[model samples]
Target: MIETIYFAGGCFWGVEGYFQRIPGVVKTEVGYANGETENPTYEEVCYRNTGHSEAVKVDYDEDKILLIELLNKYYQIIDPYSLNKQGNDIGTQYRTGIYTSNDTQMKIAKNFLNKKQQKTDRKIQIEVKPIKNFCRAEEYHQNYLEKNPNGYCHINLNEANQYSKSHLTPIQYEVTQNNGTELPNTGKYNDFDNPGLYVDIVSGEPLFLSTDKFQSNCGWPAFSKPVEKLNEKIDTSAGMIRTEVRSRKADSHLGHVFNDGPGGSTRYCINSAALKFIPYDQLEKEGYGKYKKILASNF
Candidate 1:
């Protein structure tokens, strides 16, 4: 299913460019929103004292990306604490906001804001309200960054391509999406030992630690325990009872678990395609920096 959210983070040029690179984002259009006037133009909204903020209307597939995840990514670029500005662009038109059409999205948007408040000492100045009025920006403004490569953009586009960097192969998508199993002993981390963290392929949620990995000789990565328990349920299908592992955030189908493991451990035999490894050195860049100290202590 597809859902739409309007994000106003300073200039829509950079905001639209950022989300357009995301995998699940279906479409993006620059526009003016929550203004008093109807059919507000770029000139009127920017200089004529219109209340509209430069915004980007983002449409995305919910199956591929969660609203919470997208909201988190959006916050990475903007100075939510700053009022009526982002970088050198100082004006009310560049104010940050999250405009939604319905009550459900409004709740999620506010919840995201509340969590963000706990992280910083500075007050969040971004607005969260129901969109009262909206109109598309001019044709040239729709994809300003794409058309003019050297456009004025405050945010780095790399922030939005983190998930794209872990691009999946055909087989990986088949296993994670279709719930298929990889052939035994052929997995990448089956016998490999490295001090790092493993994350979900789709949502990038941390799943396992190298410290918990044990040599069960099971042909796949054998984990004595996950970093934390995954949101999975027991599977009793095809007349076979097994504890199936699944990514709760991304809803991707991982592998199953078994009791026959080393050290009297409950083995979690997971598929390589369902996971992406973040090396100890790159953990900080991958947003799992907290685990670096954990790996160091274990080492």
Candidate 2:
């Protein structure tokens, strides 16, 4: 199911870019929300007393992401204590807010605020109001970051990518974030041989292929190679100068690479909690059709 929410955090350019990186997020549109005037233009909202705040409407799939998780994600980038401004932008238009169209969203926003209040003594300055009025911003403001990669963004895109994958199962979290290794022969993918893709559990970044998977009796899912190089990194953090692998977008902790496999190929002994398998039949619908051919020939 698809759901919509609007977030007024600093500039819509950066806010929209941050949410769009999330896997379940379908699309984002920059706009002016909860304004006083009828369909105020960008300049009017900025210069004139239109009482409008720059915001972005996000559309996402509920099955892939939760509203509560999205709310927490929203809080990570903005300063809740700041008033009528965010980042370097100083104006009423840049004020932080959560304008919801429904009562359920209203409740979510309030609950989020209340929990945050319990943690800190400072009062949250964010506005939580029903959607009074909204107008889509100029075409130039929509998807601004995608058009200009080097554009100014208050939230770091690299860190935002990791935060985008915050909705994690407990085991997934322990294994991916804490460097806790799953016991040998206890993982789900250890002996499973099927045509599909293994993706990072946290960030959904594609990592390895079933075709390259080989049983080395290592008691873990062993792959001779990675499907793509961008999904990993080399690390030497743990005493042994081992080639540590990480998800490129999220920089998530995946398994390591070793050279003790057949054909001089490397072995990637990954933990089951660190991955989510996408079977061949569901690849295309899941936006991984480009790799369907990888499962064409039976091994």
Candidate 3:
């Protein structure tokens, strides 16, 4: 199913371009939203005090991406605490806001804002309200960055690709960065089950524990659960629908989770290329000695 949401994060060019690269985003358009007048032009919004904020209308597939995930991504691009300004653009049109279409969305947006407010002492200036009106921008404004490669974009489009390219192997990069799956039954840890902690290859954050590992014969290292809370997103790629898991810190794609497992437990079919195992004995040397006691009790 497709759902629509509006985001006003400074200039719409960078916001639209950044979301376009994300998976599950069906379409994006630049427009002026929650304005007073109908069919307001870009010039009117900037100079005529039309009360319209330059926004991006995003239509995303709910089965593939959640609204919260989009909101998280939105937070990364704009300063929620800044009022009527972002980057170098200082104007009402560049003000940040989240316009929702329904009560459910409004609730979610408010809750998200409340949680964010607790994290920082700075007062958030972002407006969270129901979308009152929207007017499509001019032809040149649509996909502006895509059309002009060197166009002025306040957002860093390559922020998602922040990982060091030289550090990861070809398969690791393909799996973690590009969301490519390793060949089944060919991973280094598929058949070799040793006592250790499986960590995200990119972030080195603890993911799955050895105690949770089980033989599922699914051509991947299967675990019943993760040691840490990993991010889960709906994945509708490859002609099949599944829940894709990623490391929370690095946001690197680890693998997919399934309901089929031993004794009614869920299975975390992870990619070995996306993980780095830290042996139990070397846990102290690796600065993960805190988990040594946990691993011992499980063994």
Candidate 4:
């Protein structure tokens, strides 16, 4: 399913460009959102005090990315505590805000902000509210960064690439980023089924539980289900059709899911190179103590 969210982080040029690189983002358009005037132009928003904020309307596939993951990425590009400013831009049009149309989106945004507030002493200046109005910016403003490679952008577009290179080995990067499969029967978790959690190697987000694992004899780690939502898409590569599974937050290509499994359950065949095992004993030490109850219930 496709969902929409409006993000007013700073100059729409950088905000729109950054989200375009995300895996599940289908499309983005620069616009003025939640403004007082009707169809306010970029110049009016900037100089005429139209009460409009330069925002990007992002259309994303929920099956390929979660809303919370998008929010997490939004937080990375802008300073939530800064009021009416982001990077070098200072104006009401450049203020930080999250405008949503539905109750679910509002709740998620509020919860995310609340949790973020608990982590710091400063008050979060980001506005979270229902979208009042939106007017698309001029044609030239759209895809500004793509058109002008040397355009001024406050966001660091290379952070994702840098993170992948610094945190993952060559094989891990290959499997996760390029969808290259590991050799069958050669993965570290192929025959290992200790009590623990399997997390995405890139983002460390909890994925599969050890209790859900079973011996599928498929020469890879197999699980009945993941602990959280996973992004899935139709993969028609190598002359075969399959359902590809990916980590929602990091958008890493984990592996695939198949219908054939024990007790009519679906089998999530995952690449060990895409995951990092956190043993049950080390859950607390690894800051995954909140999941202890989930692991205990299975026992």
Candidate 5:
């Protein structure tokens, strides 16, 4: 079935760009929704306070694009916690929102929010409202990127695989490109219970060892810290969030950093997508002999 979802997250220009490139999204259009005006102009929405949010309408096949996945990708593009602005665009027109057509979408959006709430203690200001009205944006706004590639956009894809500096397997590319997390409790070293090394999936650079790993029960791989100096940290204060863990070298979204570690120390509960584990036995074979010291001593 053809599925439709309305996403409003700051300006709709960059947000529309992201969905357009996604594999399953059939079409995307910049528009206005949930507003109290008729055929509001850009200037009207911007300065006149027509109450219309700059929104994007996404059309996709259900078999191709899952609503939940789209929502997640949407979160990646916009600041979910930001109240009334995205990037330099300020005012209510740029608020983060999701306008659904039915109960199924309502449930999906709510469940996704719930998952975020469970993962982090942040207050979610992303609105989940019913589809009131959708007005197509002007002709100049449609397919803005294809027509104008150099147009300004605040959203960026900081690729982790870019730091690999080498070609990787398709699976590695999937993990790195899609920000895919590994399947927890199913990896080869998930329960090895021995000194091991976690390497960058694309670059094979040694990152963490078993000594640095802690059980966070996050269902993916969990690490208390990096081995040392392998990953650079990111200051996510721009979005009003405190801090996030991103690979400095590869620019991969490893995961979030939290103060709620098993102990008092911070936990870098990373996604398996950001790592490849090499046990002690395969350390030398994997060219990670430098990390063998982790096996000799426990930190």
Candidate 6:
């Protein structure tokens, strides 16, 4: 299905750059969203008084890039706890927000916000509103990073590049590094015979197993739960639509989490780029200490 997300996090340029580099984002355009005017201009938005926030509009494939994953990335670069400020950039236009296009986006946005609130001890000031009109930014704003690798922007490539240093294969680099996505049902794991835990592709963190996977018919891998700590703060972001899931450790693209799953379930549909699986028989041989206990308990 076609999905859009609008995220605002101070200085649309940097936020745009960050999202443009992620996988599953079909298109990335810097724009002005959630405002009163019919079509607010860049200069008008600069005043930070048109009720507009400098935001990024992201066109993504839901099957490839989950909303939860995008939101998490939005939080990584900007401080959610702070109000209308990201590092040096500060203004009403720089404020955080999630502008929805329809009832489904609205519902998912609210549910995500609620989950975020419960996890954080601080109060949330993120604005979740219906999108009014989205005006695309000047042509120079599009692919700012690609045009000039060392251009002036808020995001630090060193921080992002650190995650890219995981020795990913050529295809992994093309997708994760270039913001491209693997076609649905074309990944190696989709039809693998190996059955066991899937570790983090970059960090090798034990995340999911074949047994825990359930067919969501969503053309992606879905798991009931994550192997990591549940309270991890997945950030909320506003863009072409609003997205909510991003990983900080590897900075690699991860899938989204949702309350809706098959068989009355909660599914965390993840990207294969973010994981590496360990077959059940190879668990002990791979020096996994005692993961045999996980297999033993099942029987």
CA-lDDT, candidates in order: 0.83, 0.81, 0.86, 0.88, 0.71, 0.68
Report the poorest 10 consecutive residues by lDDT, candidate 6. Answer: 237-246
Task: Write model 5 residue lDDT over 45-91, tens digit each, in one string.
Answer: 88888888989998876864589878877887777778898899889
Q: Write the per-residue lDDT of candidate 1 for residues 195-234, one digit (tens) a residue.
A: 8998877656678999988887777888888887775678
Off by over 4 Å in 2: 2-6, 11-59, 75-77, 87-93, 97-170, 231-234, 259-261, 284-290, 293-299
The residue-by-residue lDDT of candidate 4 on 131-244, one tens digit each, is 987999999999887677689998986555454665578889899888989999999999997999998887666899999999999999999999987889899998999999
Number of clashes in model 3? 0
Best by lDDT: 4
What C-alpha lDDT, on a 0 to 100 scale, does residue 267 get in candidate 5? 71
Regarding lDDT, does 2 or 3 come out ahead? 3
Model 1 CA deviation exceeding 4 Å by range:
166-299
The number of clashing residue pairs in each candidate reads 0, 1, 0, 0, 3, 26
Error of 3 at 113 (Å): 0.5
Error of 5 at 87 (Å): 1.1
Whole-model alpha-carbon lDDT for candidate 4: 0.88
Candidate with better lDDT, 1 vs 2 = 1
- The Cα error of candidate 1 at residue 217, in Å, is 39
Poorest stretch of ten by lDDT in candidate 2: 157-166
Give candidate 2's error at residue 185 in angstroms.
2.1
Rank by TM-score (best first): 2, 4, 3, 1, 6, 5
